[model samples]
Target chain A: LAKTTQPISMDSYEGQEVNITCSHNNIATNDYITWYQQFPSQGPRFIIQGYKTKVTNEVASLFIPADRKSSTLSLPRVSLSDTAVYYCLVVTNNQGGKLIFGQGTELSVKP
Target chain B: DTAVSQTPKYLVTQMGNDKSIKCEQNLGHDTMYWYKQDSKKFLKIMFSYNNKELIINETVPNRFSPKSPDKAHLNLHINSLELGDSAVYFCASSQGTVVTTIYFGEGSWLTVV
Candidate 1:
């Protein structure tokens, strides 16, 4: 299991782009970076995932450098509904999908 | 239509009581997991089961027991619950043992009074 580090909190205005970076210096060869969005009183939802370079989805985008030591989650055109805690997880494929979540980045989208 | 679901959305029980949270996934997933989120909203993995076999068990207490009758169902039973046990328990599942995306249920909020 690889440990991940991310910002504790971030503030963004509506219609702006928000990027949250996560650092996993000890990322293993089989590790993949995944981002999840959690809203109050709801379960965490999958946003995006990436192994290297950039991966884009309907909701968000994930960028990973060649070193695989760090990754960034980018949310475009934020809205108030985007205010939630985002978790970045570095997981090994053979771990049977066991995810260790850290103190996620609390993103507050203002009006 | 509700890929992953858990029973007893809210449970308020007295200390030392026993309770169980039932979960089922209709996604045809082979792996299921149990996670606990504290008040501070930090999620921790408690257990993982793949194909009805236990694959990962974190340092959770003996009071917390998990059972998976089949690949689609996993239940968590807690005995002699303490005040510190007050947290939200979430049941999740993934397609297989690989790093496929994991889906989570709404969560069972347990309050030990």
Candidate 2:
């Protein structure tokens, strides 16, 4: 499993775009980078995922460079409700593909 | 309807006692997982069952056992719980290994005093 590193915390005001980057230097070709958003007292929710290049969803967008060593999750038009911990995970294609969640970046969206 | 649900959203017990948390998924998925979130809010995978077969068992303590009678239900049993065992446990499900999305249950907050 590849360990991921992300910012400890970040603050952004409403209507602004926020980008959180994750670094996984040892990420493998078969590994897929996925991001999850978690709020207090609730389970984490899937935001977006990408194997390479870019992938966009109704919620967020994911961008992966050629090296695949890092990925950035871009959340547009942030709101106070978007305040949550964002986790960057590198998942392998194995039988028991476990998602290793890092400490996650605490994103504080202020109004 | 709730896709994934865990019973007794909150569980409070004393140390050395045995407790069980039940999880069920209505998504008709074949895989289920148990994750523990520590005080620091770090999520760690504990056990995963695919098609009722034990697939992933992390280095979790033996005292923490997960049983899946079928594809839709997975239960976690903790024997001799300790103070450190107090944390929120989450149950999640996915279609298969390659699928990127994993739906998670609200969570079960376990407090061991």
Candidate 3:
């Protein structure tokens, strides 16, 4: 079975901060929580990845609590173009790090 | 300036046909992968190769074969295709044997009618 779970969909308006959470109860020690955004007719694009605490890149922020059971992807002041399917995956470090993808959360950014 | 690229962006073929999708990465990554996204929007890993050697093989059918000629390329060849084989095929690459935030190509849409 796949190792991650996320909401099916979310709605956000322009200029609003959007946060999508994913649960991975059995995440391994070497596993990294990574998020990817995919637009129609395109492949998944890497957004943000984190191992612990909080990691922020220019595009998004990743927050992982102490338990490592869940993580949240935060998009600041989202726009309509930010609307896309966001996938949460757990990537292990051993044996070339297997990445298992789940049914991503469809984020709808309203005007 | 594309990092990863795949050929035959779209393909339409009848069942039992043999087709192939070629992928190349210029990012000098040592690991590459093939991922399939079905109509239901479920994305799954099909195969993984490191330095032109097969490493990870999912439970995909034998008809779906992956060929990595070198560190820079991994090609997918499907034999005896079925209607269930239609989906978006994505080629991805990473820098090392341990998976990092990999890079993906635009994807090749293969339709088996």
lDDT of each: 0.94, 0.92, 0.91
lDDT of 1 at A55: 96
Interface RMSD of each: 1.1, 1.6, 1.4
Superior candidate under lDDT, 1 versus 3: 1
Query: Which 10 successive residues of model 3 chain A have the least lDDT summed?
Result: A92-101
- Model 2 / residue B59 / CA error / Å: 2.2
Query: TM-score of every model?
Result: 0.96, 0.96, 0.96
- Model 1, A45: alpha-carbon shift in Å? 1.3
The sequence of per-residue lDDT tens digits that candidate 3 reaches over residues A1-111 is 238999999999999999999999998887888899999888999998899999999999999999999999999999999989999998876657456778999999999
- Give the candidates in order of lDDT, highest first: 1, 2, 3
lDDT of 2 by residue, B1-113 (tens): 99999987999999999999999999999999999999999998899889999888889999999999999999999999999999999999999766668899999999999
**Better candidate by TM-score, 1 or 3:** 1
Docking quality band of candidate 1, CAPRI definitions:
medium
Residue-wise C-alpha lDDT for candidate 3, range B1-113, written one tens digit per residue: 89999999999999999999999999999999999999888988899999999988989899989998889999999999999999999999998876658898999999989
Second chain TM-score for model 3: 0.97
Clashing pairs for model 2 are none
